[model samples]
Target: MTEEEIIRPENLVYKKPTLLNDTPMHYCPGCSHGVVHKLVAEVIEEMGMENKTVAISPVGCAVFAYNYIDVDWVEAAHGRAPAVASAIKRLWPDRLVFTYQGDGDLACIGTAESIHALNRGEHIAIIFINNAIYGMTGGQMAPTTLMGMKTATCPYGREADLHGYPLKFTEIAASLEGTCYVTRQSVHTVASIRKTKKAIRKAFENSMNGKGASLVEVVSTCNAGWKLSPEKANQWMEDNMFKFYPLGDLKDTATANDSH
Candidate 1:
């Protein structure tokens, strides 16, 4: 079929999100950042918030999100995306504001900023990408690195006596009174991707509706950092990662309020 005929509305099964620009992403092979970016772009476009959205990108693998997603973006210092997002959201209450951050940036250096922002009930969403290890920084041990998981900084595996346990920031966010929604999700399969997309949409809606803070943690994979192929990485995440960071809504005050 001709290109035009193949892309006709009636013949289309799916299409790329209009908010996703043609710029090539710099993520490593099998990186989860690309998929999450696409989902964010899709959600923004679907909500008709393309012109009224502001994204905060901080240092890490997703720092370059502004290059691909066609949205107003602010580049923040390492671990400070939450603070910047809070300022932006407060200044422009009508805009849909969010921060895209990796585990190392959110759970480690930005721990205080993240906690306070969510605790204060900022009208914004935080998209947390937890791949365990620090993917962009030479695969070092991250705050969310699973116990016993090997990384460059933990060649002999993470020892409880030396490294402490992995931080479950999502659970912490859920416990905060200011948080209206919190969910842990993944994109390893078609079904999981669909669910994650739904979770992201709900968080965005809650933010725009003057609800309290929301967080969507995506349990992700880093094949290069883990020294595994794409297929093996997916399997490893399913077998190992999910055991500790199981998927589901940790809190859902938004839906609860709606039902009442």
Candidate 2:
């Protein structure tokens, strides 16, 4: 077959997004972080927001997120992504600003910063990645770690009596008046990946539309931390994590919400 015949747009099933840099990803094989990063880049490219998009990436495995996504980036302290994004959004209200954070960073050390920023109705999209346990931080018990889930910090499994219950930060975000959109999603399946991209796109659109704080909580998995293979990790997430962090929209007031 001729190269032109094989490379036609109709024949192409997929193409790498330009917003995703040429750098090789450091994420492990089967890591959802890589997929999520691609989704974000695709959304930005589709919206033509590459130049205007400013991503604030905080601590944890996602701290190096700025390395992958080709856009203006600001590295925030652990749990300070919301605060940083809030400032950037305010200083340049016309710019599309967002934060990519993990459970340990958003729900734990930066809980107050995340809550207040969302409560105040900042025009920012918060892409919160909830992987249950602290993945990059030695698999420690994060605030969103399910009860009875074992971790490096909780060797015998998390006990409600000592560790407390898992925090539903996204649910809280939905309840906050400052937030205009809040949803929980995953990137394990092809269908779920499409939904997540839509959710992320809506979030960025909301920021540009001045819909206030929009949070898209992606319920992810950590195979290394969970001591499971990528396949088992995804399966475990579907079986157990979904119960605690179910998929679907928790809240939506964005104008584009009705359109798609």
Instruction: Supply candidate 2's per-residue lDDT for 136.
Output: 88
* Residue 158 displacement in candidate 1 (angstroms): 0.3
Q: Model 1: runs farther than 4 Å from truth? A: 1-10
Worst 10 residues of 2 by lDDT: 251-260
| TM-score (all chains, Cα) for each model | 0.97, 0.95
- The candidate maximizing TM-score is 1
Clashing pairs in 2: none
List where candidate 2 sits over 4 angstroms from the true fold. 1-4, 8-10, 255-260
lDDT of 2 at 78: 85
Q: List the residue pairs that clash in candidate 1.
A: none
- List, residue by residue over 1-260, the lDDT tens digit for candidate 2: 79998999767878888888888888877888999999999999999998998999988999988888989999998899999998989899999999999999999999999999999999999999999989886999999999889999999999999988999999999999999999999999999999999999989999998988999999998988999999999999998999888899999877545677
lDDT of 1: 0.95
What is candidate 1's lDDT per residue for 169-233, written digit by digit as tens?
Answer: 99999999999999999998989999999999999999999999999999999999999999999
Question: Candidate 1, residue 95: CA error in Å?
Answer: 0.3
